[model samples]
Target: MADIESATAQKLLKAFMQFRKTGWHDKKISGHNPSEFKVLATIQQGANEKDYEMKLSEISQRLQVTPPTVTQIINNLEKDGLVERTVDPEDRRAVKIKLTPTGMEATAKARIRFTETFTGLIDYLGEEESEQFADLLTKVQHYFSELNR
Candidate 1:
């Protein structure tokens, strides 16, 4: 039992390292630097057009950073024309962030490149093995998430 657990940990660590290396993710994905891309991605994920646009507080929470840190990133994104800041209609004290069309385009490109890279690697593994591998990783993640909480 101990040996199996040890092997699982080793396997997960190896896969994480491989992802970090193979991710080859540069900051300059869309003519924007890494920081800019990160800010754009965060806003893109948090924003909902029809509903409430994401608040700066929400961005800070998602990034696990401080409000000031989120503000700095948002400022840069605003300058790049990837995002916009609007006065929150419901909350006079908070501002909402929304993605501009350019931001959407850049985020889409980044998602595509990442998916293509992931698909290329998955293509090398057989179907059953790939399914087994995914299942095992999911179990490992669940285990850690449970322990951490």
Candidate 2:
């Protein structure tokens, strides 16, 4: 318990807080927030993999968010003319979601912007450090994931 207040622990906490203050996660890619873009990307990927519309539950599972949260995001995207929902042909009770042509265009642009942003980050960090950073981040994520369990 005493080690929790050590200089190293304090530095780590401060650094994490400073990182959160950077607003990287809050920044919009294209006209949508990162979460929205992620949902869009997931649908796009699902389409590529299955050649079919994604179900709301599938999106929720992939994004690790609640169905209601996904519904809210889908509602916003639909309102923006970016996505559309339809009844599943094989399962009348299920709703399937697909990107609109407008959604596809926006997603393409957003993908480019997202890649460019990360590319800039990689360039700044250089290859070796960027790789190390990615590995460290993965380790940190796994640690926290395990901790939560």
Candidate 3:
């Protein structure tokens, strides 16, 4: 039983690693790398949530990256006219980040691409299996979250 469990665990780990590696390879949209797309997506999500804008620190935290890294990315995005930085009205010293019109269009394209990819996965996995996979993943995520606490 221990050997069987070990084999299962190893297979699961291998599958997860491979999935992470390949997941983003073919998902690029509008010539933006995954990191840039992630930042754009995060800001867009915040806006959809009625936040309208986000702080650098908030973006860094959400992306699980350091502030400097996020700042650099945002700077590049700004240069490409994909995002804009403005002074935060509520906090005079802090700045807020928001998507430019170009960013919105790029984000929309990326979102459509993402949806198609996931829908393909659902078709392959079958609806019931997809739901099961999602539930299992959620449970595993919660387990890891608990471990960090």
Candidate 4:
């Protein structure tokens, strides 16, 4: 049983590594890498849920990256005219990040591509299997979260 479990874990890890190398989730989205797109998407979602602004710390938290890393990415995005940074009015020390018009357009395109990919997955996996996969993924995510705690 232990040997079988170890083999299964090794296979799973290899498959995931191959998947990452193939950039399966990053290929359809143009003009940005997967990480950059994730940051853009996070900011867009935050804006839609709350105000049209998100703090740098909020972005760091959402991305599960360090503040310095988020700042570096934000600086690059700003240089590309995809995002703008402003000082938070309520907290002058804090900075707010927002998408520029170009950023919004890019994000919209990325979202459309993402939805199309998901639709394809549903078609391939069927509705029931897809739902099960989603549930399993959520459970795995929660398990990791608990482990971190």
Candidate 5:
């Protein structure tokens, strides 16, 4: 094999480019758009039935987007009956966002669809090979986390 630096990036970039579309297509069972579903999923992950809520600042940090972008998405979600915003009791200026029943259902369906797709995909690999691939991917994730830190 050529030196690692000599390798072309085209293949890797193309694969990543196709990732979103492929995952979206796989989650077609959800009916909601993939991006909308993602927002709901993110919020649901942070908030639970007991006391689930987060402010725009927290969302912006988690999604790595501007507050405006998060607001736009939330606005659409609120219209679609997927999310709602409440004035924080402790801090009148802060708003807390939470998922609606519809949003939770959509997220659950998308998760199931995604899992099914992933399972279908893993069927192509042998046990040892799949484990090795998972380990490598985990290492890459840790590498990025370290870089961010």
Candidate 6:
């Protein structure tokens, strides 16, 4: 049983590595990488929920990245005219982030593409299998998260 479990684990690891190597996530959306798009999506969702510009710390916490890393991405996005940064009026030391018009449009288009890609995956997997796959993935994530704790 131990040998069989070890072999199964090896196969699972290999499958994960191959899936990553396939570059399914490396594809750019609206000239932005997946990480950048994630930031855009987070900010957009935050705006919709709070109706206010998000502080840098909030974004970092939501994305589970360091504040400096979020700042670096924000800098790049700012340079590309997709986002705007402003100093908080109540707290000059704090910076707020908001999407510009261009950013909103880009995010909208990218969102459509994201949906279509997932829709294709669902179609390929069939409805029942796709649901099962999602449940399995959730369980895997939960298992790993508990391991960390």
Top-lDDT candidate index: 2
TM-score of each: 0.65, 0.92, 0.77, 0.78, 0.68, 0.89
Count of residue pairs whose backbone atoms collide, per candidate: 1, 0, 0, 0, 0, 0
Give one digit per residue, the lDDT tens place, for model 4 in 1-149. Answer: 45636988889788878968986865747678778888999999999999999999999998899999999888889999999999988899999999999999999998888788889999999999999999988998898999999
- Which runs in model 2 stand beyond 4 Å of their true positions? none
Q: How far is candidate 1 from the true structure (C-alpha RMSD, Å)?
A: 4.1
133 in model 1: Cα distance from truth in Å? 2.1
Cα error of candidate 5 at position 33, Å = 3.6
Summing lDDT over every window of 10 consecutive residues in candidate 1, give the lowest-scoring window: 44-53
Candidate 3, residue 13: the lDDT equals: 84
Give the RMSD in angstroms, all C-alphas superposed, for model 2: 1.6
**Predicted candidate 3 versus true structure: per-residue lDDT over 1-149, tens digit per residue:** 45636988889888989989986665666678888989999999988887778998889999999999999999999999999999987888888999999999999998898789889999999999999999999999999999999
True lDDT of residue 17, candidate 1: 89
In candidate 2, what are the lDDT values of residues 52-122, reduced to their tens digit?
Answer: 58999999999999999999999999999999999988999888999999999999999999999999999
Regions of model 4 farther than 4 Å from truth? 5-21, 25-28, 138-149
Model 5 TM-score relative to the real fold: 0.68
Tens digits of per-residue lDDT, candidate 1, 44-63, equal 77654344368888878877
lDDT (C-alpha, whole model) for all candidates: 0.77, 0.94, 0.90, 0.91, 0.78, 0.93
Screening candidate 3 with a backbone cut-off below 3 angstroms (N, C-alpha, C), the clashing residue pairs are none
Cα lDDT of candidate 3 equals: 0.90
Question: TM-score winner among the candidates?
Answer: 2
lDDT of 3 at 94: 82
Give RMSD (Å) of candidate 4 vs. truth: 3.0
